[model samples]
Structures are given as structure tokens and as C-alpha cells.
Target: MKRRIAREKAVQILFQLDVAEVQLPDAIDMVMEDSTGESTEFLLSLVHGTLENLPAIDAEIQKYLRNWKLDRIANVDRSVLRLAFYELMFDEATPDRVVLNEAVELAKLFSDEQSYKFINGVLSAYLQAGATTTES
Candidate 1:
């Protein structure tokens, strides 16, 4: 089974980073400490690595977002995209489908009903196109 709770906690921490303007590393420390699970390390890795690669991740998001700018995306949807994109792009340990599915689920939990379909469409298009990036 998935460590859904840990993923949920990471999603919350990511949300805090945007709304609360909390430093990413500090948010990771707080979230990692509070989140209990065998998957804590994986969750922490996702948060930190995604934060580290946020610029590139956002670039990818922008490529797929069509008319919307990155900043225009809801904070919850943006964070969910960052997490899922990080996993899909960098974390070979996580399957692409799992990353996309978990992101959709998280978006549904944190965002409006429209968020689920939006995230699903973006991630699906991303996957279908093989997630090629011009960035290093």
C-alpha cells in the first residue's frame, strides 16, 4: 500500500511554503519531524528535491499549462504538480503512473473539484509526451 499519510503531510508542507512563505528547508524539517512512517525519507526527499528543482519543475508546468502562467495556478495545484513532476522527472524509484495518480488524489483533497481534472489532464499530457525537458 501507499504511504498516503506521509504524502499528504508533504503536500501540506508544500502548501505552507507558498501561503505561509515558510522557507522550504525549514518546512521540510518541520514536516519530516511530524510525519511518521517508514516512508519519511522518501517523502522528505520528494519535498527537498522538488524545492531544489522548482524552477525547472515550474518551467515544465508552464510548458503544459497552455494559457496559464505558473503564478496563476492555484497554490494547491502548483504544489501538487511540483511534487508529481519531481517524482516523474527525477525519482526513478517511483513509477510515473503512481506519481500522476497520487498527485491527482492529493489535488482532489486540497483543491476544488476542477483541480482533479486539470491535474489529470496536464500530467496525462506530460506523460504521453514522455516528459522531455530542454533543461539540464
Candidate 2:
């Protein structure tokens, strides 16, 4: 699957995981129920990698938040942030620019109208602040 599509699916799966308290595999299955193919490897990796590295990702995000706790962010916005950070942190082949853009796009599509701006702000600040990843 294309990275954008895979990323979108990752957000969906992650949202289910967060909101429904669903297990990773089950959340993935629920999100992929409409797919013609089984979950693509890229999709699986994004979801798995994000979840595997979640504690680290959330901690990193907390550093960038001003007044808002991570949990207080809208669920879809949180999912987009996590997926994009997963790509930024671990998927080195994709540039941070692409990750940021895709994240904003996903937020626009799945989150409330104002959410994309918030997503963009946090990500841009993180990048400008010299974002570090586990792999870095």
C-alpha cells in the first residue's frame, strides 16, 4: 500500500486502540474490515511500531504540549500525532517534511476542522526544537 494510505489506516487503527481499548490486532482487523486485501505489511508495521514505541512517543509529545495533557487532546488528533511520530522516529526512509504534511492531512480528514492547525503546530515545534528519535 502507498504510504499515505497506510498512514491513514494506521491512524484509524490507533484511534480504535485508544478509544475502544481494543487490542492492537483486533483494532487493526476492525479498521481493515473494508479492505480488499489483508492489511499490508507497511500498514501493519506502522501500527505495530507505533504501539511498540508508544510510551516513548507519548513522552516526547508531552514535552511539546504547552498547557494540554496528551490525553486531553482529541482522540483522532492524538492518533495522527502518534502515527506521524512513529514515521518520524523509526521510519527513516521517509523525510520529516513528508511525515508532517501527511499528519496534517490526516488530521484534516479525520479530526475536527481546527485540529489540523494544532497538529501542525505541535509537529513544527518539535521539529524546530530538534526532534530526536530512538534511532537518532
Candidate 3:
């Protein structure tokens, strides 16, 4: 449930980014002001870091997205991909399986039924494609 909370908060923060374009610290303070949880920092870091490196992250996602662009994807699905893809690509402390699983769960909660399968497939492909390049 810790990851679930983190994922939910991350989604909200990512969604907020589209409208406000505020800095992460300010955004984090705003988000945390109303919410209480153990996973808040983790979510904030994930959301902020991912936003910082979104160009690279979206490039990676685009590499595996076939025909889908980040802008073309639904907000919830895009947020899930951004968080999971960031962790999978950049966060050495988090395991690939954990990122993929958490992303699928987030998709299930925030997106349509088909989104769960789509997210799983995209992330699975991402892991498979990335596995060879990872030194860790």
C-alpha cells in the first residue's frame, strides 16, 4: 500500500505539472500540505526527478511506444509510464520488476482495463530492451 500511495501522489503531481508548471519543491510542499503519508517523499522525488529528465524519459518511452507519443497517451497512462520508466531507467535502488508491477497496479487503479495490459506490455518491453545495457 505504500507504493500505491506513492503512485497516486505521483500521478496527481504529474497531472498538476501540466497546468501549473511550478518547481518541484513548491509543488511538493503544496501536495504535502493536504496529504499525510510515509511515501510522500518517495513520490515527490520520483515525480520531480522524472519531470526534470522528461525529455530523456519520454525519448525512452517513445523508443518502445511503437506509434504512441507521450502527448497522445492518456494523462493517467502517461503519468504511470513516466514514473515507472524513470525508476526503471534511472533509480538503481529500485528493481525493474517492482517498477513494472507498481506501474501496472497504478494503471489498474487510474486507467481503463486495457490500460493495465498496455502498461504491462510497454514496461515489459522496456525492461527487456534495457536489461542488456544496465551495468547494475
Question: Each candidate: what lDDT?
Answer: 0.81, 0.86, 0.78
* Worst-scoring 10-residue span by lDDT in model 2: 127-136
The local lDDT score (0 to 100) that residue 9 gets in candidate 3 is: 81
For all predicted structures, in order, the TM-scores are: 0.85, 0.93, 0.83
lDDT by residue (11-75, candidate 3, tens digit) is 76786676567876776677677675444667767887788788888888888887887788887
Which residue pairs in candidate 2 collide?
none
Please report how far candidate 3 places residue 105 from its true position, in Å: 0.4
Least well predicted 10-residue stretch by lDDT in candidate 1? 34-43
Better of 1 and 3 by lDDT: 1
Candidate 1 lDDT, 1-136, residue by residue in tens: 1467767877888888988978877876776674455556666776788888988888888888877888998988988888888888877777888888898899889898899999999899899998733343
Please tell me which predicted candidate would have the highest TM-score against the true structure. 2
Tens-digit lDDT string for candidate 2 (1-136): 6778888888988898888867877877777788866549898888888988999899888888889999999999999999888888888888889899999999989987789999999999999988745573
Model 3 TM-score, all chains together: 0.83
lDDT of 1 at 37: 52
* Poorly placed runs, candidate 3 (over 4 Å): 19-30, 37-39, 131-136
